[model samples]
Target chain A: MSYRTIDRGAAATPEPVARKIRGLSDRAIAWIFVAPTIFLLLAINIFPLIWTIRLSFTNYKANRINREPEWIGLRNYERILTDSDIWLNMQATAHFLIWTIFFQVLIGFALAWLINKKFKGNDLWTTIIVLPMMLSPAVVGNFWKFLYQPQIGLFNYIIAFFTGKEPSSFEMLGQVNLAPWSIVIVDTWMWTPFVMLICLAGLRSIPDYIYEAAEVDRASKLRQFFTITVPMVLPFLMLAVLFRGIENFKMFDLVVQLTGGGPGSTTELTSINLKREAFEKWRTGYASAYAIILFVTVFGLASIYVKALNKVKER
Target chain B: MAYSKLATASAIAIAATGVAHSAQAEDLTLCWAAWDPANALVELSKEFEAQSGHTMNFEFVPWPNFADRMLNELNSGGQLCDLLIGDSQWIGGGAENGHYVKLNDFFDNEGISMDDFAPATVYAYSTWPKGTPNYYALPAMGDANGWFYRKDWFAREDIQAAYKEATGEDLREPQSQKELLQIAQFFQGREIDGKTVYGAAIFTERGSEGITMGVTSALYPWGFKYENEPGSYDMEGAVNSPEAVEALEFYKTFYETATPPGYTNSYMGESLDAFKSGQVAMAMNWFAFFPGLYADPATGGDKIDFFVNPPQNIAASTLGGQGISVVSYSDKQDAALEYIKWFAQPDVQAKWWALGGYSAHNSVLQDPGFVDSQPFAGDFLEAMDGVQDFWQEPAYAELLLAMQKRVHDFVVADQGTAQEALDKLIEDWNEVFEDEGKL
Candidate 1:
């Protein structure tokens, strides 16, 4: 089957072009094919990063082009590390990231397990469950804002109907104590399906013969689930957690549309704070340092987490 | 017969030349905030188009992200706008960064004097170093923060009796800041026509300039100042004065005790919606939206009325307006200048005010019927007379954001004492000024 295809490819390439290609060594040919990608990676990914690192040591303001930037050494980093507001933003980010992952992983695995079982209208339920994730985060944020409104929101109405309280008794997005959890609930609602799909893939990858062999061994249902199902899906669950964690770390648009990092900085995650510094405040050099610190933190965490995932896979 | 054919050819040549002259007209894009007044500007510009052969295009952005979008365009040296109706706070940056063309010569050549416009507008919207007239723009719109209320409810007998019984005073327009708060509290949770209505919808939004502008209405009246002395960045007692603390605490009390439940992150649009939908008894917004509000069939006419923001310690209001500047990067400088020169005329400004765009020209403001022109006209003039503005420094954004965070923290989040909030604000401002080498 391959001889005809190979002959047709040789005939399709012009004779002079094929000869030129055939003259080059394999390594050079490979480089010829990949040079554009390398150039693109350098131009987009590497060069800007290097430039940002340089700017981190200077006092360059993006809006003040008339003024010359001065070299300020590590002063920008020093100031960032010492700023209490920045630390508070970091804590807010941590709170969001950890809770969102915890909730997403918990509900996602449960949904995947239940959907894995044979049931009527399973595909329909699965599609319904995945609907929230299909919408834009901005759209989700805007609609959820209406839902969280106290006077007219459907969410407050649902709460009031259950608790026999007034619909205007509480504000989900307005109060300090509830605003953080409000974002958490929305994030969990939108992204749990993403984790569920991954978990579903994990659950489906387990062969039927394994369960049959466990049945032959007289293994109880509880023992087989604890031993086989949980352990096998552990790697997939960890992968989902890693993906959601990185994403929630950079959560900006949804939170912006919801609270705008407020009820006074209670929901001011680091990304939103960084945007204020960079764009709103135009503290370019300081923001550059902030960005580098965030980049390193994410890169380091992902590297360590990836290593752990690989180890789990090996096990 | 040959002579007649030649004469016909000459007539065709003349007609083609006229068409070519018409085709030479430049299309000028004027950028501004997307609001009711932007529509007025569009309608008014039709006159400019007929007068000058240049077509007008507008790129209107919503208020929340207007600064972010337009600043990015300017920072990138984009040619998207030939003229920009930028906020007054941007005059410093616009002049310093060369984003706006210096208009001193243009004004002189066109026989336009700075004295022809309102002094406050010229100082806020046209100058760079506070009062020095390094003109970068022409004052296009004049506005200030003011209040509007439900006039029909105030006249209700039962409501008036209830308010009098509750506060031992007749329900009328508030004369002081405390009276305003008292009135708002009286309206809070009051049942009207079998529907629960709240006090007011004031700005508490955190992302942009909403809360800062709203709070400044109180701050300015309480005699808040950016500096202890003019041209000095000394903000020690001036920013954290007892008066300012009182004003800030007053605003917080208003927010806490009066505003509708779940009205936390509201700005201008939300405030307008609250008043229009009969959810609030009083609401605060810029005077620019008054024309549209008065035109609202349900809420306007006899149902609503305007008031200048009541004074606390002194007479003051927050300024809300912009100057129209020719973008330096635009290639259509001549056409853009022509638009400005045409706009600065007394007749055109009169037309602008008639079409609902606020005109800062003295000729319009000093008209015999100016005060009696509309119901809000007197209040607008009063508000503009005592209007105060935030810092117009190039780093005004940073300063405004600092105040936004500190004030929002104390007022909306109930986090800190009023004194502490102002003290922390002083610290933030000091840091910014230090960064700018102005400390």
Candidate 2:
């Protein structure tokens, strides 16, 4: 077990094998473990991003392989920037993002606050409320479509019962004014639970001693809630908003199934429009440019939002 | 002993050849939209499988996603499909991009005459350069926009009396576009059998090609043409002409006044459901669904009747349905060709019609008993004769999407004048053409 004894035995060993063992440095060993993953990331993610950026500069029609891809530098970008339809799509996406985030935060916070109170079957009630978030969005979109049907949809029937309007009189996914809201309603229903769960975690994380200290000072319940609970939960709420804002910006499948970006493009989000351009129209080059613009917008906004979230966390 | 050994070797060689021939059998996959006709095709293809010694695998995507799925498959040169039943508008793209096998040699080798198939279908579904003989597909299914109405309700004595009193004509199938409007207006919100029903259900879907398909039924009869010259993309006057504007306006008026409340984005499925549920007096749909509608015990049988889409100034029906094409990327080309050859026979075409598919073969269509084969058969013949299709350019998706947005905006969203909508559509299409260097 002594070091000298071990060194004497090592001195008697063959040099080639010992040299081979010492040849690989710790840095070299680290690289051997990491190279495959780095190569894989480059192949799957970074390479595609670079390739997409290159394709964005060419006039490439995916379906027309017979034709050569012409170099049309800045033309695709120029056209997309000037396109009125694209601007309208941006407006639609912004509208959806703001409203969905607004509703999800407000309602989700309210639900989480209610569930945080000690009550009978609170765990069961919380699980039931989060079920919408658990279901597949595609399934929800399809069923929500039925629910918005003017003739037989229960959603319309419920609205009619409350408002004294005919069930078939209003078209939720059919009218110009109402179609946008229809998508909003469905998105809110499916995702509010996600926001609720995050808000609940924030609520539960607040220590009981903070409230106990406030109670000793004879502060009102409403004042204590505003002074302590609201501030404590603000960062988590901001984090939830940031997640929702990014997700709703790229909304496609649900809106596609629900309104299909219609009652005349009132709900055509950026993602749906991009898909139409790339796949349906086969304008791969133009779509790539459009996609890059979208990526930049989302990345820029998300970075700013995260900074704000971190600042709140520090506070 | 040498002669006997030679005989045994010859017998073994013949048996080996026979085994190799049997082993050549393939499992060919045919891709198409999931629809009533697709189900019927599954039944008809059994005969082809039995005859050709090839098993068939079907990939049927829903109509909404069929184009996206199949086009991606074709564009990626995927071998998922040996044969594709592509939409009529896809002929130009498929042919130009070499997604479809050039069938001129195959047709000649198989002795399959293009003349035997319906000329309109051959033009719409086979040829890439419009009317040229450059064949890429075989006309498999023929469809056109036609009207189905509640004949039982129209024949009610009291309702007939009321219609006569109001319009001084029998409440029958409409003969003119104006009369169709009048009839629709008469039936709008009308009570029948203690239930209130609306006038009609037409295409208003906006996500894909529904609005364009539905509106063109009205547009064609009003003399809406895509261009002044056949190949030229000069759509300034043709698409937004005064007549086309009038036709579009009439369609919007009909939609606004006659259609059931909350029928905003209805397509084939929605229209069928509306009719089957007895919510509408008239429904506009493709001829492919007539057999199924006629067989329905509740709303069909003796209760319903169909008519050719009524004319405005010219007689025309909007063409639908697809042609079967061998995928150029298929590994099983021989087996795919065999399926087409077997499917093109006169007897097989007749059986196709009998199995609820619209057979485009003239041998089946011109049969003496063909018109009497089904209730809507005669109207189908008339409609097919006058059928017109939308643009079949390589950039057809762009053109079609432009029309969908423009038409849906005007007709469904009530946003702009018909003239403005068509003018905007002309602008959108011209941009696409300019991008493709066609302008």
Q: Which candidate number has the best DockQ? A: 1
Model 2 misplaced regions, further than 4 Å = A1-21, B1-17
Q: What is the per-residue lDDT of model 2 for residues B49-152, given as tens digits with 9 covering 90 to 100?
A: 77767799999998878888898899899999999999999999898888999999989988999999999999999998999999999999999999999999
Candidate 1's TM-score: 0.97
List each model's interface RMSD: 0.8, 1.2
- lDDT per residue for candidate 2 within A172-287, as digits (tens), equals 99888888888988999999989999999999999999999999999999999999989999998998998899888888989988888888888889999999999888899999
How far is B14's C-alpha from truth in model 1 (Å)? Answer: 6.5
Per-residue alpha-carbon lDDT of candidate 1 for residues B1-439, written as tens digits (9 for 90 to 100):
9999999999999888778658768999999999999999999999989877789999999999999999989988999999999999999989989999999999989999999999999998999877897999999999999999999999999999999899999999999989999999999999999999999999999999999998998899889897899888888899999999999999999999999999888899999999999999999999999999999999999999999999978999999999999999999999999999999999999999999988999999999999898899999889989999998889888999998999888988889899999999999999998888887
Minimal lDDT window, size 10, model 2 chain A: A12-21
Best-performing candidate as measured by TM-score: 1
Candidate 1 runs further than 4 Å off: A1-19, B1-20
